[model samples]
Target: MPYPPDVERWRELVSAYFAPEDVNKALWVILHESGGNSNAIGDSGSSLGLFQLNINGLGAGLSEQTRFTPSENIRQAAIHVATTNNWTPWGEGALFRGEPFGSLGNKPYPGDKKNEFAEDTVAIPGQPAPPVINLEDIDEEGFELFSPSGENFEGQFDGYTSNLEFAEKRILNLVLEHNLSFDPNQGYGKTTTDELGDPVFTLHEEANMWSEVFFRSEQGLERISALRDSGLTTAGRKSAEAFLDTSILENAAGQKNFDDFRSRIDALAAVENIPIQRATDIASM
Candidate 1:
């Protein structure tokens, strides 16, 4: 059966985190949990979002606003499923244990929305098992994956290290071009001073820290793009963009004005037609 538009979107999100075969199973759990509502709150508001994540327990450290976001909620749920290799966290999991990737269509949701365990056999009696497909082998064409795989799925920081390196090189050039004063006598850049008071400044470290500011702004743009693609509200996209624009000024190369920094880099990138994923990528390059 075809899912409703919103439900299909949630299924796509689940596919982003879980293996292709497991997507249906995960979505089945989602149907019972939140009914495909991204903003659904249950368990007296303690549990929030699509999977009805418990904020006090598994959903700890994430803000309420974040939990309400569909992408994040699905990602967290997928992480739990991957970690335990079982859907044990949610109440629905207890009902369908042992055979994690079994055909969910056969196991209809209990008439009531209540998550109750059934004394049914682990696998459908005498049924053939589902084929095991590795997550990495799946050709996810349209989906923009935030994480590479479910196994040890850390949040994606695709070009962070390279961005830092590029930023450091740029900063070194900037420091040299601008001739920013670093008093060797006072030991300015966190490295030891030579006998002649010539300081060996670890400018790379400074560049690393400074580069993070730009990287964050870049990451914010990526998230905003994802949000737009996901059909998030204009107000939400604007709010996120506004925050990113404002925050970049605080630590971006000691620049007081956000517009100056952003515009300058953007203008240059535009001229060259560089497909920049990170701000520092074009800026430093």
Candidate 2:
């Protein structure tokens, strides 16, 4: 079934969070289970969300708010797939052969000594007797259940793997470009307030600012200290003040202001060779 429009949006959001290869594998499995239709929350009450998660009795791990949101749902679903795939059941099946029993020979003949090969039945030495090998004694090759003769199971498995790889790549690209956060421990769920708590700036942006202010500037520390001390009402100044007070940043409404202040300080330090001691002296004033 085609994904619901809302579900598609959710898929995009999820793709933004994972690697492209992961996205493909996750989406493929989700389609197989739920066809990407959020409404298909199964009659058995076992399936939920896009992946048809079996929430049944499982404690409410996924946030209720995220359970229904397409973006959040997909994100959680992707995480679910990753988690399940990592487990011995799913991971082994995908990584190794699905049927390990087939490696052993077929059943042995009945009444045969364990591990003993079957020999022709013997009657009196004078009379010839039909060979009476035990049915259980036959060591025939075990049945190939997953890949039955004339079946194209290999092709199907290959297709699934390919899809998984594609999804993973797409997801990875999205994450790199958007700075999406992930927590394997959290699995997939709505972005917690804490998860979204960082200043709403990309890592690259933060790194760049840090480099200019601390590395390039001769008096980088001093200038930064001065900026922190400056009673400026600018967004950057406010952010610095907040940073000084809390030592932690959040994605609240004032992040932009704080980020701007951070950038300005970095730029000033880069452009001016303000000595750290001098900046500190100014800050002391």
**Candidate No. with top TM-score:** 1
What TM-score would every model get versus the actual structure?
0.40, 0.29
Judge candidate 2 at residue 150 and give its lDDT. 12
lDDT of 1 at 242: 55
Where is the poorest 10-residue window by lDDT in model 1?
142-151
Q: CA lDDT of 23 in candidate 1?
A: 72
Every model: Cα RMSD to truth: 18.3, 29.9
Alpha-carbon runs more than 4 Å astray in model 1 = 94-285
How much lDDT does each candidate structure score?
0.48, 0.35
- After aligning candidate 1 to the native by TM-score, how far in Å is the CA of 32 from where it should be? 1.4
